[model samples]
Target: MALVLPFEPNEPSIEALVALVKADMERVNATILARTGSDVAMIPEVANHLISSGGKRLRPMLTLACASLSGYRGDGHVKLAASVEFMHTATLLHDDVVDESDMRRGKLAARKLWGNEASVLVGDFLLGQAFKMMVEVGSMTCLDILATAACVIAEGEVMQLAAAKNTATSEDDYLAVIRGKTAELFAAACEVGAVLGQRPKAEQAACRSYGMNLGIAFQLVDDALDYGGSQAKLGKNVGDDFREGKITLPVLLAFRRGDASERAFWQRCLEKGEGNDADLDQAIGLMTRHRAIADTVERARHYGAIAKDALALFPNGQAKDALMEAVDFCLSRAH
Candidate 1:
């Protein structure tokens, strides 16, 4: 079947696709609220602050969408979606604290509002709720998948911490980092849908492939946006990653290709953390000069192509079409 491009009429907007699952999404939202409530007032207060913050809920939305495609007729998908959301939310809460970020989605980060202790505890609470939801589904397949993903995500954060402020990180190391932290959940979210839908192994593998590549592409775009995106889009100041000494693909490529002078520039800014406004500007210029941003976008497009190709196994329909649209949307951020 021919792939449906995002702008094509056959390719529904994210809005229309979300509307298709509106009822299910509502159920997921209710489940999230009920699960987030706690005896300790601080728990709900910190949890809901981040929950209420604006996020597209893309991971859970993917769970619902893939479930629809798999022809799941039970209520399991709703709980699974909620589980996916809680798992994702838990990650975000911990991530902000780890990253020492003060803002999230254009507002003060939950950690900034509440101390790091509350943020960590609330994040732990969310993970507990996520696991409970997984058990409620009584699907061993789902539980194993999500539980493993959570562990890998934690490992990824540790790997990133080890790599931080170290300019010697390779592209392969960077890929491993994103795979564990970001793409693992995406793969689990879609794979669990196939399990719940009872599709054959081949279809489940395809969904997993789609989610994995889509997630890689999504993270790649965010890396690009870190240097190029505005505060409005990124929810944090631009160039935050550089300031944090986090080595991403753009930085990786630029560092590899730079001359002695350019390498020293990266050393001073990223390694020594001695950069100022001019250093950030120079970093961007160096990346541009080395074509790092352009190359990074190219890498993201390659993954996006893989994501679209994974949908080829499934027949052309609204679910498949919307999935393709979502891939296009991920790539569009590069523009």
Candidate 2:
């Protein structure tokens, strides 16, 4: 039997916000397809395949939610939200190629289906398209934030590559990598919304901080799920990070807690980048003994609380409530 996880419905206000974002996304997608042209039809196809795949679209939704919470009532939010989605999609395309991942959202990855060369080129094209959209939005400040985020994301990827299979990675180092690779763009999304809304600089910074912390919590929970969640619920195979030799929070904690014999087992599997079922069971057992999964969950909850605290500066409203709900949702999601 396949595993199933529970999901709560979004808050009522979130439903309305989601509708607006979806309508805007369709328009933006149309614009992208038209710009790509008929001669490059495959580009649109591949792009659409990835775009239409079922994702929470959390980043773009964050842009919209933040803008609305700040009393923004303008059409420009749509374009800005679309820009976030484009940037996110571009990153996913490139990440799949880099990770050699075959599945995403329970579907074949764009790189796996269309080949890595096509995927990378399309990813670059999306990045260029995102910048073009930013220019059209006509906010120099927004552009600067996004451009800087792009650089930080690249740096984070490099940092992760260096940290891979290195069990000595500290919690602080892991936080830095997660902030760059995952949270920076999320921060940029909300920050751009504040810029568009002409919000106060301090409030804008708060929104960015909220997004950043929420993103870190989201990714941390994701890493924990890899160890604790079933494949049917997670939409991917079990022990994927183990197979890829990626050292995440649980593994780091487990290593720190391990004794001599347990440490030797990790050295063979993690250091040498090779593990079988028995090795995976041993690793899981060691992690359980160390209570690493619970520790990671505590870390995720801490960030989620920080995210909620960041919104305290904003006035109470349905949008603000929905934003708070999103933080709760991130911490509570089963997969």
Candidate 3:
């Protein structure tokens, strides 16, 4: 989603969180830039194409904010934050290849520009760098958290592949796909901060819960936007999910709620891979008729509320306030 937002006078803003972690974020950015360098020319070129693509880098920012809020004074959070970003970047590169996407963050996808082989190999290279940074941090608990997230994210991608183009994919199955693919990394990012702070297990768990819920909300909003938002706002073309036959939450809800004729349309467009530019319009109309996009956004709001609640144990401060606003910032994208 675009980082820019229309003015909402009373809305909570991510600016607070951005200001809160600005210094640490600088360090994380430096680390990311430094790590992208390689003797092989193509590696840095392909990696930097996405790393510098202005995608907001929210995942790494979460790590920094959580660390600051948890009172972590050490520098390990910098390395960990960079690692979180690399993992995310790697996934995006792989995702573009898998989905055969043309655009990302308003530009041609790295896979499209660099070819799938370069994209995948560079993605692997980034994964290696990410793991190296994680190891350098020397926190076993932190390492374990990120390592497990890596594995779970891979499993989630495979799960999504399995569920792709299947109109019968259930809501539970959809949730499982996102939990592993998206939320797992968010959970790990926040939890590792608490680990660095040597906070109590309860606080660590709370951080994980906050990130996990936020990630779910974030993905759900993206799903809604795929059918309901503008291309300029969404970065990628609208109806990308429909064209790719991805079984997202909006499609699942609409498919389950649609009439027999509606079901046939979805089946023909999604399951049978018969969708075209015109089918894209029909798909959006169907989603609107079924309240699919609206309900998907409503579900995001539900998770966003849960994410806010997850931070309840933390004392009220700039850190807490900024983190709270971050959730609002995520939800505000729907508007």
Candidate 4:
């Protein structure tokens, strides 16, 4: 059940982009470790566990990449990148708690390692540290963008909670949720980079658009993979979304395609949150019958293409090329 990409993977441009992202991630983590200090030994342990779990660090890398592409050669980019990563890691810690997830990136979650109390505390600490880093930059604009993004992210989580196991959720509703939970931070990441680079307003807007579209595409692919991906590759069990009664794009599309009885099945599972194996299988059957999975993949690709288009404003260079490669990598990820 490995998640398959729509393309081959031999692009040198993509390779270079990944290398740059990896290098920046190393630097970001080192900076975080230095800042956390030894007094809070548990802080380092928890943070390292999350960091070592092997995420793409795409958000923070976007910050660095966007800054570099804007011709920034200052140390501020490093702090900004680390701030983005911290914010992302904080969200992950909180999300795992909310989702009651046992695994992330194929390892035990922070809450699983420590208690929920520790996880929540450390998550708050990370958030505060992120804000402190923002203050150090002394950019009111950057702080304002991040603060707004954080608020939107929290609201998105609440919206998702309200939508959970509720078949009445519309596509628009879904878009709103992901925009807050996923895209807002991404937008802030790139926007912060542009701000750090002191780019023009139009260029900053373009970077924001790129980040937003990329985030949407990234999350759409993630949701699609829940149904189409291998447990090993996804680092989670197949059908976990259904089991948890989370209504995602595939389920929503399937509901739209279902007959009365099939709709009744959805009601029992998604609306009522009472799904068993039979119901789960029936839901999968209905989704496949209507090509919901394929439709979702196509939609994700559409957004991915939009993300690439947003980068068209920039001239061709290593950083710009790498940004495009990162977009392709998002579309081609098998995990």
Local accuracy by lDDT, each model: 0.88, 0.83, 0.92, 0.84
The per-prediction CA RMSD against the true structure, in angstroms, equals 4.1, 4.8, 4.4, 4.5
| lDDT tens digits by residue: candidate 3, 96-183 | 9998989889899998888999989999999999999999999989989998999999999999999988988988898889999999
Q: Which segments of candidate 3 are over 4 A away from where they belong?
A: 1-8
RMSD of 1: 4.1
Taking the tens digit of each residue's C-alpha lDDT, what string does model 4 give over 243-295?
88898999999988888888888888877778887877777778888988778
TM-score, candidate 2, is 0.91
* Ten contiguous residues minimizing lDDT sum, candidate 2: 11-20
Instruction: State the displacement of the C-alpha of residue 181, model 1, in Å, after optimal TM-score superposition.
Output: 0.6
* Model 4 TM-score (2 dp): 0.92
Candidate 1, position 330, lDDT: 77
**Steric collisions counted per model:** 0, 0, 0, 1
Expressed as tens digits, the lDDT of each residue in 1-335 for candidate 1 is 99977684443247755776889999999999999998889988888888888788888888888888888899999999999999898899999989998788888898888889888889999999998988999999989999999999999889999888777799889999999999999989988988899999999889989999999999999999998988887677889888888889999999999998888888888888898888999999999999999899899999889988997988888888878888888788777
How much does candidate 3 score in TM-score?
Answer: 0.96
Question: With candidate 4 superimposed using the best TM-score fit, by how many Å does residue 152's alpha carbon deviate from the native?
Answer: 0.8
Better of 1 and 4 by lDDT: 1
